[model samples]
Target: MFQKILIANRGEIALRILRAAKELGIATVAVHSTADAEAMHVKLADESVCIGPPAARDSYLNIPALLTACEITGADAIHPGYGFLSENARFADILAEHKIAFIGPKADHIRIMGDKIEAKRTAKALGIPCVPGSEGGITDDEEALQVAEKIGYPVLVKAASGGGGRGMKVARTKADLSDALAMARTEAKAAFGDDAVYLEKYLEKPRHIEIQVLGDGKGNAIHLGERDCSIQRRHQKLWEEGPSPALDDRQREDIGEIVAAAMRKLGYIGVGTVEFLYENGQFFFIEMNTRIQVEHPVTEMITGIDLVNEQIKIAAGLPLTIQQSDVRLSGHAIECRVNAENPENFRPSPGRISYYHPPGGLGVRVDSAVYQGYLIPPNYDSLVGKLVVHGRTRSEALMRLRRALDEFVIDGIETTLPLFRVLVRNADMQNGDYDIHWLEHFLADGGMSAQ
Candidate 1:
């Protein structure tokens, strides 16, 4: 096991890694930007270092400074708790050159899976189901039109290097395809410095489900289970739950085995997620996240597995202690992301929090880095905290989440708490008949009426 590890990120996830390291008797070093000089993770870590200014390019995303911090602190491994450089293949290679373990997958695996075009190819080669689209990136509008016609209408044009819904456009007609392609290419070039874009058949109202897989360096891998992240806004997940409500027992086992086999075949290690879009009784691969997800706590709550500890152990040349059969899903879990934003306009509301209280009870967990009197800076993500609750069934979990949201309080700033309160009471959500467009429609239709 590594004696020390450096966390290369910020916010609640950074704090989460620190706590996990402490439990495993591993020292933690936190890297923060000038904006986060007094962040909660910095206070809890055994050591803290200032990397750069508030801008992500100079701070959290700066790879050289992170490597230097590791050298200065004598840390043997670096744990990127999502976002920033967590999925950067170059960063992984740099750590490998320095003989410092990158507590994730190999650089080659990252490189292969980071590009949407290559990931699709790899998934197809592994016999994993994928959405029908162009064989590779489209070189021009003509090729895009041809591919769109072949794939049928309602196709999506996506940047090869995109995530977070950036550089993506949906075209439902031939006339829209050319314009969408041009715009997506421009956005991809500006955002990712790559003009490459690919076309894929888009499934309207699909349920966004993902399987969590853990692997050892020795080619052994198993899936913890699946999470239904269909509750989202503009491609950002809002509410997530374990043992996806959409999957039957046979479907779950089938997808789980395929995902585990793909990971093992690719020599993937540590923790990762294989995302898919399910609609019309079929599943299609979307992309793979090379690090822990924000909604991972829901999976942990149901499985009772410490994913962070497992990542560290895998990096230290230890095989996974648990097998597929050993993994068991006990109950339904839900996570609602509470962000510091206006519930009406959905704009960032950064200010000093005058009053703060997190709900707590049996099977309720709160992951946050803010407190009363703490000023939410405008230089970072608007997320203030996450309220996660677990129960014996989905309906029971919904009831618990409603109660927990009512108990949560934050003053001096508008938040999405009200939004969740309204969501939990919606009939579509209550019956599990909601689709990806449900939230957008609900919000656009002036929200739900008072019951």
Candidate 2:
């Protein structure tokens, strides 16, 4: 077992990892920037180290500073709690070279899955279903046109190494293809420093589904369940739920087994998510997140598995503690990502939180690091917290989420709480009748005003 672990990120996820490490009797070292000196994770850790200045480049993303902190703290492992440097393959390799364990998958796996193009190829090679698209990156404009025509109209031009919808553009007609390709390539180059782009046949309406998988880096692996993250705005998921209304029991098991078998075959380790676009009773592989996902709590709520705990154990060279049959999805779970932003414009709103109150009850859980009087720094993500709820059924979970949203309060700053309060009451949301683009369309059509 690792005697000590250093957390390499901040906010709610860092706090989440700290609690899990404490439960396993492991001492934790929290690294923070000058801006986060008063952060909750720093205060709660066994020891804290100021990495650098406020800027992420000089602080959270400083690899050498992180290494120095580890050396000084005598920490044997580093747990990157999503975002930041979590999926940086070079960081993992450097840690391994220093004989410090990274509480995630192998460097090679991270590299393979980090690139959207390579991830698609790997998924197809593993017998996982994939969307029809170009075999690889399209460098020539003529080749891009040819691929677009072959895939038919309404093809999506995507960056080979992009995410969060940064370098993606939709071409609805032949005239749109050239512009879409140019825009996507420019965005791809600016966002990821790579101009490589690919093509895919865009489905008119699809739900975003991802399978939660855990592996021991041996030939052992298991899939907890699937999460339906269809509710989104500008490709950012706001609401997530488990036991999707779109899938039946047989379909769920089939996808879960396929992902688990693929992980076992690859000798994967730690936690990973295989994301897909589901439409017309089929799932098309899109990408793989090699680190814990922002919506992982939804899966944890349904499976009753502490994923962080399991991830730590796996990093400590532990074997599979539970079998596939042992894994069970007990109930329906829902998660609402509460961000510090205007409900109407979706702009960043950061300031001192005058008064704060989180929802509570038997089936409700709020993951947040903010408190009354806490100054939310504008230098980082605008996410204030996550409100998660679980119940015996999807309808009951929806009811619980509605009640919880009503109780959630954060004063002295704008938040998306109002947006959620309205969403929970929407008939489409309540009935699970939504796709990835549903929220955007709803907002455009004055759904919030209607509520």
Candidate 3:
């Protein structure tokens, strides 16, 4: 194990990593922007350093400042808790050059999976199912049109280096192809500094399923099962659950084993998610997240594993602790991303939290860093917390989620709590009869207003 670890991000995830490291008897150094001087993680860490100003580019994403923090703190490892520099391959390489361990996958693996086009090719080479479309990035307008026609109507033009729904456009007809391509390229360049885009056959209704795998970079890996993230808005997942309602035990085992085998072949390290678009009883590989996911709590709840602890251990050259056969899904788990935003318009709501009360009870857990009177900085992501619940069955979990959401209270600002309250009672959500587009359609039909 590392003597000391520096948390390279802020918010709940940073606190999550800090707690994990503490459990492993490791000292923690929290690096934060000026705006986060009084953040919970900073206060809890053994040492805290102000890296830079409020802007992410000058703070969390500032590699040089982070390296200086590590050097000054004598920290041997850094745990990037998702987002920011978590998936930056160059950052991993830089840390390696400095002999500092990065608690994540190898730089090569991150590079391969970070690019959407290369990820698809690599997934196909590993025998993972994939959607049919352009074999590589399409630059010419004529080539883009050809690929779209071959893939049929309603093709999705996506950024080769994109996530979070950016640089993605849907062309429902031949006449829409050029405009969609241009729009996606422009957005991709702005968001990722790479305009390269690819095409994929769009599935009207598919569940967003991801397999969580952990590896030791020694050809040893295990899959913790899958999470159904179909309840999304603008490609951002809001509600996530384990043991997908659309899949059975057999299907789950089959996919889990396949993904584990792929990780072993690639010699992947730490925690990674193999995301797929599941439709018509088929799983199409979409992309791989090279770091911990926001919805990882759902998987941990079902498997009784600490993914962050495992990630740290793996980075420290520890051998794989659990076997595939040892992993089991004990119960249904659900996670609601409680963002500091307007439930109806989805606009950000950041300000002083006059009062805060997180729900608690058996089978309920809230991962958050905010508190009463904490001033939520408007410079970062709108997410303020996550409400996770587990139960013997999906229905039981749903009921528990309902009670927990009702108990959650955050005053002096708006939140998506109202949205979740309405969603919990909707017939479609209650019966698990929803797809990737379900939330968008629900909102389009004035579902929130009706509620």
lDDT of 2 by residue, 217-240 (tens): 879999998999999999999999
| Model 1 agreement with the true structure over 325-431: per-residue lDDT tens digits | 99989999999999999986789999999999999999899999888888888998898989999999998999999999999999999999998998898888888
Please, what is the TM-score per model?
0.98, 0.99, 0.99
- The stretch of ten residues in a row with the least summed lDDT in candidate 1 is 442-451
10 residues in a row with least lDDT, candidate 3:
144-153
Positional deviation of 109 in candidate 2, in angstroms? 0.4
Q: Report the Cα lDDT for residue 179, model 2.
A: 90
- lDDT for every model? 0.91, 0.94, 0.95
Candidate 3, pairs of clashing residues = none
Local lDDT at 310 for model 2: 95
Give model 1 RMSD, 1 decimal: 1.2
Please, what are the lDDT tens digits per residue for candidate 3 over residues 242-298?
A: 989999888998998899999999999999999999998999999999999999999
Best by lDDT: 3
Query: Where does candidate 3 stray beyond 4 Å?
Result: none
RMSD (CA, Å), candidate 2 to true, equals 0.7
Error of 1 at 38 (Å): 1.4
